[model samples]
Target chain A: MFAIEANGQKIEAKKGETILQTLTRAGINVPTICHMEGLLPSGTCRMCVVEVEGFGGLVPSCSHPVAEGMKIRTNTPEVMQTRKTIIDLLLSNHPDDCLYCARNGNCDLAKLAADNGVRDRTFHGERTHRPKDISSPAIIRDPDKCILCGKCVRMCEEIQGVSAIDFVNRGSKAYVGTAFNEGLNVSSCISCGQCILVCPTAALSEHKYIDEVLQALADPEMMVVVQHAPAVSVSIAEEFGFKPGTDFDGKMVAALRRVGFDRVFDTSFAADLTIMEEGSELVHRVQNNGPLPMFTSCSPGWVKFVEQFYPEFLPNVSTCKSPQQMMGAVIKSFFAEKENLDPKKIVSVSIMPCTAKKFECGRPEMGRDFVPDVDFVLTTRELAELFRITGVNPAAIEPEPPDNPFGERSSAGKLFGASGGVMEAAIRSAYFLLTGEELKEYKIQDLRGMKGSKELRVKIGDLEVGAAVVSSLGQARKLMDEIKAGRSDIHFIEVMTCPGGCINGGGQPIGADQEAIKARMNALYQIDRDDRLRVSHKNEWVQRLYTEFLGKPLGHKSHELLHTHYEKREVLL
Target chain B: MPTVKSVETILKEHPNAGRDHLIPILQEVQESEGFLSQESITKVGRALNLPSSKIFGVATFFNMFRFQPKGKYHVMVCRGTACHVKGSGKSLDMVTKTLKIQPGETSRDKLFSLEIVACMGACGLAPVVNINGQFYAKISPMKLQRIIEECREKEQTHANA
Candidate 1:
């Protein structure tokens, strides 16, 4: 380490660390828009430019390495003016629709301007007059609002390995768009919305369903019911001033109640239902010598990725519907029958930490009885906005339990928030189904944490069942190539599109750091450790549903309500 | 004209090529087919193991590649600062109205394609139009009409032969 003076304070700087990293470690807040952790620093955003004592020009601290005996001035008057001028030019050409924009208060450019005390648009120019692109089911692209940060372009190409959008045209005329400037639906876009999460402005956002959901809830005739996904409760708390990974499961239910939902249910309860069907399906496949490696079909983004990139693996994917869809299916069918309400009147909504769930709920196959299984899917941000509009803060409200018949869930179901949770949940019940006994330990340490790819082997009565868990489509592609090259040891594989699973899903809180994701991930593991029922097979309510409504796991009723099919999608038009 | 060679024929030239060679692959296909067809782009992506979106991104970024086929007679009217300061804009307009086609477009009869180029290195001839590699220097709108008619008459004679 070498000594460096930052604001007249001497500190040791690591050998290869950037000036930005060293300054950040010392609690000096530097504003940045284009720099994201784990991504190559482009230094395109000049917001992090700082003055080095010996250097001739102000350098971008994000990419410039700190030298020995270097003196850095991060907040000098000249540097501040330069930063303010760069932002002023950006704001001059940017659209002035922040009041009606999707990320009005959450926009990075707006926040930077406010922090810099730039109240007036001293430098004014022409803004791009492009119309908003709402062609995709889950995402919107507004070129006029883009600051040309290229965050979405890098996120889509580098992280997700889906080059649906890129820089098209030249220089000032260039903008992020699909091939041939066509709609995103025609391109190889999978509607993951990972781009929206990294976008510093409202250039990209989830297609809004707030208006439709609000209208449905206000209708007296419609019996609007909502379900919270396993990961949403943990991440949504961050929007309400709660620490990341702070579990507000009960208080969230109370907030939803105050927001006028007729009934609230837990998607984890339906996750238990998924384990029964998927676990039994795995057992049957293994016994009958079916496909060797079975892929989990919960994350819709991963399912769409398989459909577009790896169509051959469609058969290997388990046919179970996602827990969110299962809850919707049950709510529209069984709940309709029990309450004696018209199936059409029961508008099923899902609160999920995923933007892809919006597209999944609208799939043609998800409709039954001439009505869609889920009516509207809201992201955690949208639900938080709903609570704000309703003046129902979780902090002020008393916690309440979820409605019965679809409320009580095993800790195994709650594990679905993390990456390997699905495989772990499935194995806990699958081992019992095959051996007639539970595993010695409840928590499978092998399938936990934020590792990109992992392998675990569980021996069940002379049968060695091997499973693999992967997060991020890029990593999934590498593992898939290995599988195609004939890695037959893998039996069950779980893939989550977002890197840290649903807890760190694209629809979760934006600007969430690595620590935030880990906290949210650990919160789910904590819930699993605290719950009495460690396995899905031990959930008495799920057992009751099998006995009272559905006959058995993978049986007729279970297949009708829980299983779904896949189709190969055309790559280009 | 139909695509004489499949994308595989061009891709076979680079068996181990990946996404980096997308531009070269597109250039090869456009050279043979006279345009980058949707089928060729998709097939090139499959052969290169790259997403079609990335292929399209590269194809659209450069001004040289055309999605649609050009007309039998390709005409480029230079609009360099030298030509623009002179009277190339009027010449471009006259040509468009004569063919009833805009710049970067082909006529319905497939007789001519129009393009507005920044320069053709013939600024000595203040206003120049390059037609099928032959330069018509110091051109006028009325003279341009007569020159196009002369080309049409030559085409008719060639067809009759």
Candidate 2:
């Protein structure tokens, strides 16, 4: 470490660390718009400019390595002026419809402008009026609001490994667009929404279904049924000014009731159902010498990723529908029958921590007889907005349990929110299915936390089951290449499209840092630790449903509702 | 005239090409095909293991690449400072009006194509217009009209014959 003077204070700088990293470690605030955590600094925004002692002009601290005996001023008048000028220039061509924008109060550009004291636009120029590309069912691309920081482009290409959009054209004519400037629906976009998570402006956002949901709620003929995903309850608390990872499960159910939903179901229940079906499938594959290394089909984005990029692995993917879809199928069929209500009059809505869930529900295979299982899907952000508009504060509301039947869930089901949670949950139940005995320890220490990829081997009687868990399509690609190379050690693999699983999904609260994601993951683990019902196979309601309606796991009835197939999709690169 | 190579054959030549060879591959394909087609770009992307969006981005960044084929009469209008000062803007407007096609576009009949170039290093000519490798110095609205008419009449006479 070397000593450097920053803002007239002596600070220690680590070897080969950038100026921003060193200063950030010392608790000094340096504002940046284009600098994404854990991503290579592009230094295009020029917002983190700092005055170096010998430099002729302000240097971008994000990319510049700190030198010994260097004197840097982070907030000098000249540096502040430059930062303010950048915001001013960005705002000059930006649209004036912030109030009407989806990210009205949550926009980073607006916050940066306010922080830099850029009260008004100082530069005048001709604004480019590119129409909003509302082609994708999950995401909307508004080029007019884009500041060209290239965060979304880097996120999609570098992190997600799906370069669906890029900087097309050159100079002033350049904008982020898909190949041939075509609709994103035709491009190789998996609707993961990782791009939406990194976007700082209103340029990229989830396609809202809140209006349709509200209209359905107001309809006298429709019975609106809502199910919240496992990751949603823990993360949605952040939207209501609560601390990250605060479990608002009960209060959120209460809010859903206030929002006029006739039934509130927990998607964790469907997660338990998934464990039963997927676990049995794995055991079947292992005993029958069927396909080895069966991939989890729970993540809609990952399923689409396989369909488009890795069609050869389609048979390897478990045919079990996602928890959201499973819940929707059950709600539209079983629940509708139980309540003596017409399936057409029932609006099966789901609250998911995913944008891909929106696309997943729209798939033709997900519905039957011209009626979709899930009529509308709302992201965690959209759910929070719905709560706000309806004046229902989840924090202020009394905690209440979800409705009966599809509401009861095991702690293992709740663990589906995190990266390795699915593998851990499956192992807990898979061991029971194979040997008819529960593992001594329910918590699989090897398969926990926020690592990109994890592997664990379990000995069930004589058969040792090797399992692998991976999040993010990039890590999935690496594992897929290994599987394609004929390295066969794993029996089961769980893949989530967004890194850190659904807790850090594309449709989660924006501006959430790495700490927020970790806290959310920990919150799920904590719930598993505190709850009494820990194993998915032990869920009484799931067992009752099997005996009462569906004959057993992987039965004919289960195949019709809980399982589906995927076809190789042809995309424009 | 050289025989054009198919996209598949061109891709076969660069058997082990990676992302770094994207530009050279794109240039080779564009040279053979006259312009980059969606099929050719997609093939290049598959060969390089790069997304077509990235290829399109890189190709669009450089002005040398075109997406559409050039017409029979490729018109290059010099828009250098010297030519602009000599009323090349009016000549450009005249040509656009006569051809009913903007710069960097071909006419529907495929007879004329327009291109606004920075300079041909022909500043001595002041205002310059080049068609089929033949340069016309001191070009004006009337001169451009007469030249277009001459080309159209030549086409008509050839068709009659």
In order, the first chain's TM-score in every candidate is 0.97, 0.99
Which digits, one per residue and each the tens of the lDDT, describe model 1 over residues B51-151?
66677767766777877788988999999999998899999999999999987678888999887888999899979999988999998898899989998
lDDT of 2 at A87: 90
lDDT (0 to 1) per candidate = 0.88, 0.92
lDDT of 1: 0.88
Runs with alpha carbons beyond 4 Å of true place in candidate 1? B1-5, B71-73, B87-113, B131-136, B139-161
Q: Encode model 1's per-residue lDDT on A1-573: one tens digit a residue.
A: 879999999988998899999999988888888898887799998889999997899999999988899999988999999889989998888978789988977888888999987877798666767778888888888898888888888888888887888887667777888876778877778888889888888889888788888999899999989999999988888997888989999999988988899999999999999999888888889989998699999999999989988899999999999999999898988889999998998888899999999989989999786799998999998988888877889878889999988988988999998999999999888888888998889889989999999899888888898889999888898989999998899899999999989988878888788999999999999999898888988888888988888899888998888889999987662
Query: What's the TM-score of every candidate structure?
Result: 0.93, 0.97
As for candidate 2, its clashing pairs are none
Q: Give the residue spans of candidate 2 off by over 4 A.
A: B93-102, B108-111, B145-161
Clashing residue pairs found in predicted model 1: none
Here, model 1's chain A TM-score works out at 0.97
Residue A508 lDDT, candidate 2, scale 0-100: 97
TM-score of chain B of each: 0.83, 0.89
